[model samples]
Target chain A: MMRLRELAHARTGDKGDISSIAVIAYDPGDFAFLAEHVTSAAVAAHFGATVRGPVERYELPGLGALNFVLHGALGGGVTRSLALDAHGKSLSSCLLEMELPDPQAPPAAP
Target chain B: MKTVRIGSGAGYSGDRIEPAVELAEHGGISYLCFECLAERTIALAQQARLADPDAGYDPLLSARMQAVLPVSVPRGIRIITNMGAANPRAAAAETARIARRLGFGGLKIAAITGDDVLDIIAAAPWKLMERPDETTLALGDRIISANAYLGVEAIVQALAADADIVITGRVADPALFMAPLVHEFGWDMEDWDSLGRATVVGHLLECAGQITGGYFADPGYKDVADLARLGFPLAEVRADGSATITKVAGSGGAVSLRSCTEQLLYEVHDPARYYQPDVIADFSAVRLAGDGPDRVAISGGRGAARTGMLKVSIGYRDSFVGEGQISYAGAGALARARLGIEIVRERLLLTGVRTSELRCDVIGVDALHRGPGTGAMEPAEARIRVTGRTDSLAEAVRIGNEVETLYTNGPAGGGGASKSAREVIGVVSTLIPEAKVTPRVSYQVT
Candidate 1:
């Protein structure tokens, strides 16, 4: 297993209660691998209860990036949220902790 | 191919000033744009304006102009900014005063107005975009400010009129950078593709140092050199809408393909439909290529027609919040911090404090990312934070007061206790028809 951070870098932006995170692959060759493993359901499940609304994902093949818009993610927005990181700027690193199967590893003797 | 160079001066209201001075002095550019307003900034500025008539603009306007005008004005580098916040006329007048004091007479400064649509918003019933069931009337007197995101038309008009400095209130962030392109290239307002490409350039350079390795340094993963004195960004934009993003020679930070790609999607939701007042810009097909050291080429930005509707940011008084923090160190510090939080939580419940929402967090452990997949490590030191949202300032104060009492009564080794309570300013959005808003420009010469 390999951490997603080894394959991509991410940044986070917030508007109201919605948090938008874009995960971009380091190499264009890894784009398809990231797309297959980093599903919206997996991201939503990774965030668990922190994200109260549905997670919508968009793909950008030309840029080799995936944009995830997490609704109701700020705990009622920055102005009202009591979270230490009101903007959820660090949430991008949290999403990077997802473990994925190593493509370089040989297939388990079938 | 004719190309124009534009420099990004300031990213936000409180950004570093020396980098902008460096841009004005060393960076060979025709236009210098400063984007200084945030979502909740105008609302707070409006409250200040209500308190004092001449104090609604950005506090650092004089300082920025004082530092940049002498160098930028003499070199014929036009200045464009949204630093006007809640007051552009006053900001322009102040800039003119600064220019005159600095012996730069006959410098024309234009202030773009009509972004404030409080009367239009109050007169009609518009549905709130965030809350569909609610209307403008639902906010009522609590609405402190309503400023529409203006397009590049007013800024373009000011630039065309030979204004040396153009100050605006509540223009779109990207429009501040794109207006100069529109004016220099003579791009028609109906040219959707050109406008879209210009928007891409603006978005990339709008954040100043973000694209120049300010926010992108990861010790081992992505190493950026000389970040302490990171230089701001500039773009050499062509008449055909393609551009190369670069910074001043020998300045700190880098302008690589990685930095460009990271900033291309910064604060962007859907890459294909980046909604701006000028056009619905499409960046899904945008490509970045490394040209040289500290330079990257950008292309493939397209756009469709605008939505004909303008988004208005409505700022209202939401509620009050009270917070308190205390620290503990040495062995079992995490245990002491957790015990302190539990004590404060129980005290607030026992004291009958009315709170709509409350959060108790142990800093350095799970304050930012709570719930599953957290709390696997034990730290030698920890800080306890107890924050609560209440309807009134008085109730909010009590929430903090309860936590402060924990320093002496509840937890052992609790120290450095601090508490604060303040009123919250909430921001929401609604759409208004384009015809209902009008932009006007007035000039002041030094």
Candidate 2:
């Protein structure tokens, strides 16, 4: 399986206590697989306790990207959070560690 | 039908100054925009104004003007900026004053104000969206400032009046880019699709160097060239609201599809509905194409009607943050640092110093990932950081004192000890009716 870092690059933004991370594919051809596999549930599970609220994913087919808004994720936002990366700037790189479907695998998998 | 080449000069208040000089010197552009204010910067500036009447604008305002004005003024490049922070009139006056010193006699500077609604907000029983329980009346003297995010109308009006440079208070970041597009292309304020497309261009150009590969480089995976002298971004916006993102040729960094895509998603929440004062831009339909090296063209942005209310950022006195750090090196550094943290924790409890929240982290060990710490291998050194949020300044100073005392009373070989206690400015959001605020542009001719 290829890591999400190989297929996509992401950036994170914070508003209040929420963090929005956007993942965009390097190649337009990989967009379909990323959009299908990288669901809100999957992203939510990846962050786990790092997020206190729900994770919502918005699809941008035109740009071959997915936007994930993680609520209650920034502790108390930038002004208050004691987190080293309080704005969740480094969190995007952590999300990039997500495993993706390997291109060399079988044509279809359940 | 003419295209406007606008270069982004400054992304934030303290961004590098040399890149702007590079843009002004070599980059051929009509207008250069600098975005300097953050959510809490104005509140801090308000505190500064309270201390000294003539010091509310950006501290580096004169320095940046000195660095950029000489090269830019003779080149006939107009400037737009929110470097005004808490005072646009003062910033505008200062820019004109600098122009006179630099012998630019024909420069006209405009200042946009009326974003400050502290009186109106204090009159009503308005509660901030973030703090539903706390009303404006309740905040009382702690309220430092409340400024609404203005749109592109005033900025466009300044440009229309032949102002060489436009300075504003608090404005929506994208609106800074959108104002030029509106003034150049004569695009209607109510045209959602075109406005939406223009907003995309503004958003792409808003953060100076991010779109040009300054913030996107990875060592082995995503390599970028000459990041030290990285060039800022420029957009060639057309009459139809479509634009091409490119930088000065032979400059550092690059403008590729990956860089464009990453910047497009920066600070953006929902792809379909990005709430701007002018319009709700829909970037879902936007497409990106690489025309040539260091060039990316973006189009197909859709927009909805403007929102009835505008967001206001209210700043108030929160709590105080106290921090202390000291490094330990050589044989038993990790163990010594751990002992130091434990002593401070016990000392605070013994002294009955109450903190609302406390965080202790071993810097080299597991501060970021919180994973295995120097497991099998014995490392050279480590640092312990003790941070706490206290209600009072005295209490905050004690938190640092407790840590600093560790150098003498607790740990061995603890060197480079430092301590600081600072006030925290908290920003809350509220919505004010669009009609409640009137953005007015006033200009001075030198």
Candidate 3:
């Protein structure tokens, strides 16, 4: 179960629109797996419709982790209509799904 | 019994490290926190293994808690401390043993670890965006030790478990005091205002009566009645987390605004955002009020969300350092000391043995008097300390032996100089990041 979200009129004056998020995964290891799979290109495609800036890496030294910083996303210039799943866990699921290898199976053992 | 009291028992010597027990048995306080770790304490403990295998553990640390732990277990008096350095589980097991020896059974002992992060620096894939010293770390080898300064939740759980003692690794100084306020008051984890009050209390009592006059010197208390019987601080916290700091009767030292302020600012920078594992307490919001006779009431503190990860302490055997000093007496002794330094330097250079670092100082000459003046120069001597870093002990020993040659070949005796200088064992300091560390906990019944 996963979901996406949309906030139209919630604006933070002069400070840029704040994006509050909660990233969840079933297995604790999957959180790390998703972070590893979601490269800059993958992150851009996930939020591609709206954000128009560079993806910077967040070095979380304390927690032994990293986060991708999505810069210049909310300034009113892209497709605002975004689709979401039911449980709001879609973002992390989408990132995790990218970790799955292509199903073509190397053109057969025959 | 006084309305408010805070402090450790001063008379208890070694093997009596339990400040909390003394405070409760005699001081009559509401809250108690025992602070045992220092910046280089863990590293020093590691090095002490070479001298004595059993020196790793502070034996006195356990004896302090023997008396009050049983009394506080049922009554719910909280005890928090960083007594779990290097080996927390062993300490926890020792506590349990002490409890059972006293016929206190079924005591729950929870050991909270995961604060040691020395290994994290090695496994880290990326570098920190910023460092305190701004020095670029080339590899993980730079770290010597890593221990996290965890919050009081683990101690709080141990308290909730009806444990006789809550043993923990190197938690923040304030967390030891804060945990009880959180557990007893049942304050919300995110409640900044309430947490701030607890934080303020922790700061006031962290140094054990530092709020009174342990560190600060007051004109009125220059000769505080009894120096030997000084009292430690006791914090009586309210439901809202506001606390009053005071000491027991018949104790030495005076608590005043000046003294409390001096203790508050000690070893802390940026009161606006003092950091811990849980919250960034704003010390600026706190107001200190002295109500006379060793009582300081603290209120109106605040906090912000924590911003960064906790840093750790690390150490390792990088090199050997040996220092030798010779005291020269009578006139021109300082000149002889200066000549001694030149003699050692040139000799080492000639022998093709360059030391990693060398420091030499001539005391009593320029120290008591100015430059080489017309006056009778006092008895002085040159002290030369040479330290070398090498994988081989033989090489370090060779450098130490080289010091004797300087005496005969160099300038003769000034005025009854000391025989030889002392050898200085080197203990290097290193910082550990929070990610690579964890504490291990265990227990046993005495």
Candidate 4:
């Protein structure tokens, strides 16, 4: 298994309760691999209870990036949230921990 | 081919001033833009205005103008900023005073106003964008400030009138950069495609150092040099709306395809439909290419017609939040931190603290990412933080008082306890008809 951080870098932005995180591939070749594995359902499940609303994903093939918008995040927005990181700036780091199958590894014997 | 070189000085309020000074002195630009307002800033500035009439502008306005005007004025680098916050007129007057003191006589400074739509919003029935069921009337007396996100028209007008510095309140962040492009290039207001490309440049340079690798630097993975002396960004925009993002020579930080790509999607949700006061910019088709050392060329940005609706940010008094933290170190630190959290949780319950919401976090262990699979190994030290939201200041104070008691009463070796209670100013958004709002510009000549 390989971590998402190895292939991509991410940044998070917050507007009210919604959080938008964009994960961009380091190489243009890895864009397809990231888009296949980093689905909205996968990210929604990854965040679990942290994001209270549905997750929407937007693809930018030209830029080799995937933008994920998580609704009802930030614990009621930055102004009211009691979280130590009010803007959820560090949430991008949390997203980098997502595990992906290593394409370089040989297939297991059947 | 005529080109305009615009430099982004300050990103947000309280951003570093030295980087901006560096841009003014050595950026070799025609216009310097400072985006210094955030979502909740105008509301807080309104509260301050209520207390004092002439004190709603950015506090650092004096220091920034004092630092940049002396250099910018002589070079004829026109200044554009949203540092006016809740009071652009006052901010412009302050800037004029600084210019005269610096002996730059006859400098024209413009103050753009009419963004304050408190009365218009209160008089009409507009539904809140986030909460569909609620209307502006529901907020009523709780509303502290209501400012519409104005577009580039007023700013363009100021620039046309030969204003050396333009100060404004609540203009769209991108408009601070886009206005200069529109004025210098004479791009039509209805030219959505060109305006869209301008918006891309504005958004990239809006955060100043972000494009120059300020928030980026991941060490081995993405190493940026001399971050301590990171330089601000500038755009060499052409009449065709294509631009190259670069910084001053020998400045710290880097401008490359990686940095530009990260910033291109930073804070952006839909790359196809980025809503701004001027246009609905489309960045999905945008492309970035590395030109040379510390330079990146960007193009292919598109835009469509605007929504004809203005987004107004409403600031209201929501509630009060009280927080307290205490550190636990040495052997069994994690265990003691957990114990401290549990003790404080029960203490708040036992004392009957009226809290609408509460959170308990161990700083090093799970303060940011809570739930399972977060922390792998126990640490030698941890800081336990307890925060609660309450309706009243008295109740909020008790929430922290309970955590402070943990320093002596609950866990052994708990030290450096700190507590604070403050009122929470909540922000919400609603839309108003574009025709209902009008932007006006007033000039102050030094």
- Against the reference, the lDDT scores of all candidates come to 0.92, 0.87, 0.52, 0.92
Which lDDT tens digits does candidate 4 get at residues B1-446? 89899999999899998887788789889999999999999999998998999989999999999988878888899999999999999999999888888999999999999999999977877899888899878887999899999999999999999988999999999999999999988999999999999999999999988889888999889999998999999999988899999999989999989889888988888889999988999999999998899999999999999999999999999999999999999989989998998998888889889788999898999999875586667888999999999999988998888889986798899999999999999999998888999999999898
Task: Score candidate 2 by TM-score against the native.
Answer: 0.94
CAPRI-style docking class of model 3 based on DockQ: incorrect
Ranking by DockQ: 4, 1, 2, 3
lDDT of 3 by residue, B1-446 (tens): 22223343322123234445556766655545677765455655545544654444445566666766765655555455566666566666667777778776776666667765655644654333222343324433544554566777677777666654566667877787788778777878888777766787787777775555653442332334554555676767778777777777666777765456545544343455667766878766566777767777777788876644665544433444443445554566667667776776676678766456554445433222122231244453444343343334555455545555656666667333332222222222233433434444444434
Give me the candidate number with maximum DockQ. 4
Taking all chains together, each candidate's TM-score versus the true structure is 0.99, 0.94, 0.64, 0.99
* Candidate 1 local distance difference test against the native: 0.92
Ranked by TM-score, the better of candidates 1 and 3 is 1
Clashing pairs in 2: none
The CA lDDT at B237 in model 3 is: 72
The 10-residue segment with the lowest total lDDT in model 4 chain B: B369-378
Note the residue pairs that clash in candidate 1. Answer: B106-B446
Q: What does DockQ come to for candidate 4?
A: 0.83
Model 3's chain B yields a TM-score of 0.77
